[model samples]
Target: MSKIRITKEFSFEMAHALRNYDGPCRNIHGHSYKLFVTIIGEPKQDDADPKNGMLMDFGALKKLVNTEIVDKYDHSVVVYKNDERLPEMQKLFENIIIEAKQPTCENLVSDFASTINTRLPDNLSVFSIKLYETATSYAEWYASDNPTE
Candidate 1:
């Protein structure tokens, strides 16, 4: 079986702080983030049609991430752990959701990748998530099956 991999990029704005950091990162700040999501898997076996043999539909994948993840954080503030301001912010807008843990680029990528992997079909594997906090800085988290190694 032949395997296929696809990557998609999306961008959104969010605010967060580095928890327990003594440096400048400890201060609240925001970034216009860019995300790259990579999915990989063997082509489906039953579909004789060229298009049908694809591991997954790009449009559907885009829709899934856009609806479930991207839309939730776009233009929103992502805080580290819990802060007293969270409830106040939630009242002002419907966008705030408490993260299970500290909010950092690494955790954000991991969380989003894990959530997406769980929602996808078993045949499709979410290989990696790269989140760019700035044009020069980014973080990447990979699953065990990632071909990039």
Candidate 2:
């Protein structure tokens, strides 16, 4: 009857350029992005259940995170739809992805969280998502932080 949360750390490399920004960041650049994905669930009550007493198996969590986020975006360039470089970059990269909004650290984390939410099992809920753009700069989203939105 009690809720438990589990988090796993994952890192991937990605390049992105902000749209309409008059700064060095407007140019394409890459970062070794670190992500922490957390999920919440209640321990299974049935002792005979395969996942009894655990929120989720670690292997299951790893597989979900890798397939949903890491494998898709790692080593790919993320460009905003309106970015001027989108056209030129598309022709250059062997792999690239376009986002509807500027791919800032905050936006990237939000995207991960939203996509991760859809991939989770019905019994689990996303508790929080944290993304670190650099050693010091990062963003986080917590389900409890927002209400009546």
Candidate 3:
């Protein structure tokens, strides 16, 4: 039993903040967020050909992220809490449904990882998600059996 992992990078710009934060981050700010989605699994038997034994197809992965995730946040202002604009987000959600705990990159990464994991083929499992809010700032989340305290 062998496992292979594949990652795809994506980016989108949006505005958000830590609601009620006592720090500067409390103010709404925008970031050109970068996302790294990792998928792991054993090779597909149907694609046993030497060149394409992996469970994932790069093109399919791209399509899943692009259509299901990136395209939704392209130029939207992401809010931590519900707002009047939620109706609009609701519309988009109808199609792609990318929602988060809060609009922060960390939360975004967690939400994305969970959502993608649910959408992936049964054999493919999501391992981790890394989100970069800026060149120097980022966060990571993984599927863990033990929750962090």
Leading candidate by TM-score: 2
- Per-prediction TM-score, please? 0.83, 0.94, 0.78
Best first by lDDT, ranked:
2, 1, 3
Question: Which numbered prediction scores highest in lDDT against the true structure?
Answer: 2
Q: What is the C-alpha local distance difference test score of candidate 3?
A: 0.73
Residues 2-97, candidate 2: write the lDDT tens digits.
Answer: 889999999999988888889999888999989999999897778789887888888888899999899999999999888877889988997888
Native-structure RMSD, model 2: 1.4
Model 3: worst 10 consecutive residues (lDDT sum): 92-101
**Residue 133 in candidate 2, Cα distance off native in Å:** 0.7
Candidate 1, residue 8: how far the Cα is off, in Å: 0.9
Instruction: Tell me which of candidates 2 and 3 scores higher on lDDT.
Output: 2
Q: How well does candidate 2 score on lDDT at residue 136?
A: 89
lDDT of the structure predicted as candidate 1: 0.80
Clashing pairs in 3: none
In the predicted model 1, the residue pairs found to clash are none
Residue pairs in candidate 2 whose N, alpha carbon or C atoms collide under 3 angstroms: none
